[model samples]
Target: MSRVILFNKPYDVLSQFTDRNSPSPRATLSDYVQVPHVYPAGRLDRDSEGLLLLTDDGRLQARIADPKFKAPKTYLVQVEGIPDDNALAALRGGVSLKDGPTRPAEVERIDDPALWPRDPPIRVRLSIPDSWLRLTIREGRNRQVRRMTAAVGHPTLRLIRWRIADWTLADIAPGRWRDA
Candidate 1:
């Protein structure tokens, strides 16, 4: 049987096992996961947080990471400004990106989620209002969620991947991992 690991990837931690570019040491998967022969199924940017799946089976990893598989990835996004109906509709309909038009997304305004605080908090602007959004998309484009929100005139301030298909971040804390 294949070993599946669910990790709560913390902010500023690289998705890879090693950080070769930086002369100074940077946080990476090796710092958290000690399980041998396992590799991340997909990547989460260093600035992003929450659920990341790892597996020893190449086929299983492909199933989760490949965009053609259309695995739904959900995010709890904090944007710089309050989004209105038009903006929400644009997201639901699929916003045009530089690469191409994205697939339609399931999006809704939501209250801030109950989550652990980051070591360094996201910047706040007193004058500009912020709002939370629950967004679900099928495609795993690079930085797609962040870019989508920006295209809709609301740049994402903080992003957390809450779910991927049936798996979720429930019971997982930042920098922690568990067999799933």
Candidate 2:
């Protein structure tokens, strides 16, 4: 991507610059990014947060956003409960979704990333234990990581996209960005 910017999108913020459909004003990319003409390459759900690529080049945007490119997107996922080997295998092997079966993913259980405190913390259940997973997929499906985790009986509580293609969030803090 040319004139690319790697932004660490915060939770509850829309990927687009404008929120024309929202009845009330909500946090959007415009609130964080002021570089003119640079648009988000792909979307990070308002509920999910982390690395979002913005580029002035349209071709770069397509390459990063398109599933056909198979650009690997890695996530640090916090799930409702610890996953077992079988569940992880299911994710690694690919699961059937409403859209279709997913491509086999690279997934593994992980310890807490402890990056930033989400503005409004994810709800915690006193009895149910929570765990983390590092998952990487090539497709940019709607809520795919969350859906995949849920499909294996471990609903994701907090999802963070840490890397896309060869780019990574690295030291970028929440709501901050750097040109790449």
Candidate 3:
């Protein structure tokens, strides 16, 4: 059987095992995960945090990362401003992006989730209100959640990948991993 590992990627961490191309040292999977031969199934941007899957099996990686498979990924987003109803409706209807129109997404505003604090907390703007959102998308795109929210005029302040496919961050702590 192939080994699958679920990691709660911390912010500013590179998804790979090494930092070959950069001059300055950056934290990577090697800093956290010790299991060898496993590769990340999908990528989460260095600035974003939460659930990331790794496996020694290539086919399972493809199934999780490939757009054709349509594996759903859910995010908890903290936005710069409160999104109005029109913005929510527009997101639900799919907004046009530089690449193209995105697939319609399931989105709703939510209360702030009770979770571990980010090492470097997000910026707080007392003058401008911020809000939380639960967004689920079937396709994975480069920084799609951030871009999508920006398209609707509310920039993402922080983003966390709460779930992917049937797997979730659950009890995994920052920079920690668990076998599935």
Candidate 4:
């Protein structure tokens, strides 16, 4: 049987088990995940927080991590400004990024989610308005959600992956993991 672990990666924690290059100790999966022989199926940037899947089975890992599988990943993003309808439409129709045009995504504006407070809260400008977005994409590019929001003129201030395919962050607290 495959050993699958669902981890709620906290901000600034590396997806991998070790950080051999850094002189100072950095938080990593090893800090939270004690399960041996399991490796992260995909990666989450150090700045981002959310659900990450790890598996002992290479094939299951590939299915979850590979963009070719088209598994949808959903994010709750807080952006610098309110995105207008045109911006939402642009995202839905697919925006041209430096890499290339992205696949059309399911995008919608949403009310602020009741989430745990970030240790170092996001910066806020008193004069500038911010808003939340629920975005689902099948592609997993490097900092794709952040880049996609920035492309539509609303830079992302905070990002959290809420769901990846059938798995979700659900009740998992930051820096915790559970067997799935």
Q: Cα RMSD (Å) per model?
A: 0.6, 0.9, 0.7, 0.7
- Candidate 3: deviation at residue 140, Å? 1.1
Q: Which stretches of candidate 1 lie over 4 Å from their true place?
A: none
Worst 10 residues of 2 by lDDT: 107-116
Global CA lDDT of candidate 3, please? Answer: 0.95
lDDT of 4 at 73: 97
Which residues of candidate 2, in runs, are more than 4 Å off?
none
Least accurate stretch of 10 residues (summed lDDT) in model 4?
171-180
Supply the global lDDT for candidate 2: 0.95
lDDT tens digits, residue span 27-47, model 1 = 999999998999999999999
Runs with alpha carbons beyond 4 Å of true place in candidate 4: none
Per-residue lDDT of 22-131 in model 2, one digit per residue for the tens? 79999999999999989999899999999999999999899999999999999999999899999999999999999999999999988787788998999999999999
Task: Please give the CA lDDT of all the candidate structures.
Answer: 0.96, 0.95, 0.95, 0.95
lDDT for position 78 in model 4: 97
| Candidate 4 to native Cα RMSD, angstroms | 0.7
lDDT, model 4: 0.95
TM-score of each predicted structure versus truth? 0.98, 0.98, 0.98, 0.98
Give every collision pair in model 2.
none
Error of 2 at 51 (Å): 0.2
lDDT-wise, the better of 2 and 3 is 3
| True-vs-predicted CA distance for residue 121, candidate 4, Å | 0.6
